[model samples]
Target: MSRLRRAAGRIWRVASIPLLAIILAFIVAAVVIVVSSVFTSTGLDVFLPLGAYGSLLAGAFGSGTGISNTLVAAAPLILGGLAVGLGFKAGLFNIGVAGQFLVGAFAAAVVGARLAGAPGVIAAPVALIAGALGGAAFGFIPGFLKARTGAHEVVTTIMLNNAAVLLLTWAVNDLVRAPGFSFPRTGDLGHSALPILLGRNVHLGIPIAVLAVFSVRWLLDRTTNGFEIRTVGQNPNAARYAGMRPIFITTLTMTLSGLLAGVAGAIQMLGVIGFYAPGITASVGFDSIAVALLGRSDPIGILFAAILFGAFRAGAPLMQIETSVPVEIIDIIQALVILFLAADLIVRRVFRVRAAKPVISELATVTRTWAGGAPPGGGA
Candidate 1:
């Protein structure tokens, strides 16, 4: 019974902050909606928030199409969230997910375009692997620099993001311009496209993303490598003292993170867009950082958070069309969710929630890295 209580308490601690944060964000968003309505020439619409939220829920889940769209949109977000979440677990913030995602997409596009005449069995997996490898290679740059020169991943990754965009833009326009297209875009993926599972938009990537969630959870909870990564994240000095190589762990974690984000980009291109284009990313890489933070770096938590964000993305258009609530309101709500989570003390105080106590939770571990201004156990 005590063990059950402890386990439940642990789960509550892991979940409460994000849940409360989301609820508070929605409540605040309702007020913003009301205030904005009052400012309009039309008198205040007191029921606007309720109607907007209802429409959003309906657009996300009310019909078969809505469900499919939600899952399809969620697929890449899940992968991207996992990428950022994994980096967080290792006490690293992989801000370069955008670059890694784009580079991966480019690599996959090139490979996928070349394999257009081939069978799906041959082309799909190859494109996926190409994307992962491309992402891994790009990821290695920052990891190597961080490990060797003590440079921060955030700075290095941001610079790489610019470099990647420049390179890919040039490649698309000059080198791979689809045999005479004026716009910068790649050729159709053809057979390399992920098989559709439901309607037009739903595809195999949804299940693949779901599978990745368990794979990542297993790696962190049931593997030796996960233990090493967490140790290095908590204390590079301790890991070094224990004869573990912190440098190597850091590099590996970042590489895997890049791989996931690369897969995200690849799947988005192959599954949804059917080609690589500049505007296809739709801010997924940036949104993933919020997803990871809200999930507290747990793979399972990241999945749920990704889906929630996905629902917002999938439903926002309908919500705007139906209720005239600006789609930016969704962004505001998401930002508020992040803000509340970042200020957990406010949430705890407002909700009358107590700390889980004595036991060191994953949330505490991640926060220690933030508060200390370095990876735990010693400066990175």
Candidate 2:
């Protein structure tokens, strides 16, 4: 009983951080709404917090269509969040997921367009594999540089993102532009390539996303490679001393992470858009970083976080129409969640929670120390 109690306590400690942050964000949003309401002719009682929340709920879950849309938006987030979370566990910050996603989607579009007349099973799987390869190839660059030259992955990955944008623009315009369209986008994917789940709009990607979450959970918690990743993340020096190769692990982890992002792009293209364009993903790659952090780098946690964000996204338009509040407020709410998580000390202090020992992200430390010209003892 005592042991079970301790295990329960540990789970709560891990879970409570994000929960408190989310609660605090909503409370602050309510205060903002109420304060802003005072300026209206209807006076201080015009915009009640509960009313805003009710509209949000109604917009997100009131009908089958709303739920389907939410799931559609969430599917990419699950894979993208996993991409970032996987890097976190491996002691690497893969900030180039956005670039990887773009390249991957482009690759998928090219392959899928060519496979227009193929059978569904062959075309769908091939397109997904092509996307994974494209993303993995792009991810390899930063990892190679970080491992070989001691250059920071942050710097390399950010530069690579800019490069990817240019590459995508050029590729779309000169290489894969649809034969008769005015817009610089790829041709629509064949019907065989698209997977339908609920209706025309919602696709089979949701189940695939859920499967990815479980696969990642198993990879990290029950596999030898996962053990290596966690060991290196915890202490590169210790891993090196224990006969592990840091460079190989770092490169491999980034590649795998990029592979996940690539799969996200493929799913988005095949399941949602049915075509490729520069802005099809909107900000999913960037938003996924927040998702990974808010989920505390856990695969299952990422699934739930992605769904919450998806709910906000799905409901934002209705919330705007019903409450006369700007849809941008949802962005503020998301930002606040990240802000509070980044500064967990503030949450603990505000709630009088015990000071839990911090989980040090070794990548952060390595970045700081390496830039100062003295590589740490562990081969990082």
Candidate 3:
């Protein structure tokens, strides 16, 4: 009985902040909606005055198509969130997910285009692997710099992001442009290279994303490497004292994080876009940071957080079309969610919720360890 009660309490504390933040964001969004309605002279009242929220619901999950779209949108986000979340777990900030994602997509496009005649079993996995490798390769740059020179991953990753955009532009224009096409894009992926899943828009990526959630959970909770990662993240000094190499751990964590981000790009390409094109990614990598933060770097929490963001992305169009409310409202609401989470004290105070004591030993250790300065145990 005591164990059961404690378990429930743990669950509540884990879930309460995000849940309350979301609710508060929505309440504020409703107010924004009302204000926007008042400003618009020519509006349908959405055909019902109280129908803005209803429209959002209908657009996101009112039908099978909506649900599928939401899932599809969520797939890449889940992967990206996992990438960032994994980095957070290791006391590292992998800000290069955007670059990793783009490079991965570019690699997948090249590989998928080349494998136009292969079987799905052969082509799909290879394309995805190519993307992961590309991301890992790019990820290595920052990780190596950090481990060897003590340079900040944040600065390196951000610079790499800008470099990647130029690189992607060059790759598309000079190398992969489809014959006789004016626009910058690779050729269509072979039919077999296309996603095999529920329908045209939806793909196997959803299942893959779902699988990733469990795989990551198991890795973090039940594996030797996971223990090492946690140990290094919690106390690099202790890890060094215990004979663990911080350089290797940091490099590997960034590599794996990039791999996940790369997989996200590949999934989005093969599963949704069916080809590589410039601007295909609409800041999915940046959004993943928010997802990771909202999810608190937990795998399960990331999955749900990704889904919520996906719903917003998937439904924004319909919500705008029906209610005449600008789609930017969704962005506002998302920003509010992040703001509330960042100001947790405000949320707790508003709700009169008691703060939970820290239970995890390694929590927030990442905030201080990135500069590669001496570890807590007095090691370099």
lDDT (0 to 1) per candidate:
0.84, 0.81, 0.81
What TM-score would each prediction reach against the true structure? Answer: 0.94, 0.92, 0.92
Q: Lowest summed-lDDT stretch of 10 residues in model 1?
A: 371-380
**Model 2 bad stretches (over 4 Å):** 1-4, 38-43, 355-380
Model 3 C-alpha lDDT per residue in residues 1-380, reported as the tens digit of each score = 99999888888776788889898898888877776666678642433335666777888898888999899889989999999988877787888999999998889988998887888889888998999899889888887777777777889999999999988988888888988677888987885365656655778789998999999999999998787777777778789888887888888888889989998988888877777777776488999988987888889999999999999988888887886777898888889998898777677778876555541332356457555544332334
Q: After superposition, how far is residue 157 of candidate 3 from its true place, in Å?
A: 0.6
Question: Could you tell me which 10 consecutive residues in candidate 2 have the lowest summed lDDT?
Answer: 369-378
Tell me the number of clashing residue pairs for each predicted model: 3, 1, 0
TM-score of 3: 0.92
Using TM-score, give the best candidate's number. Answer: 1
Off-target runs (Cα >4 Å) in candidate 3 are 42-50, 354-363, 369-380
For candidate 2, what is the lDDT? 0.81
TM-score of 2: 0.92
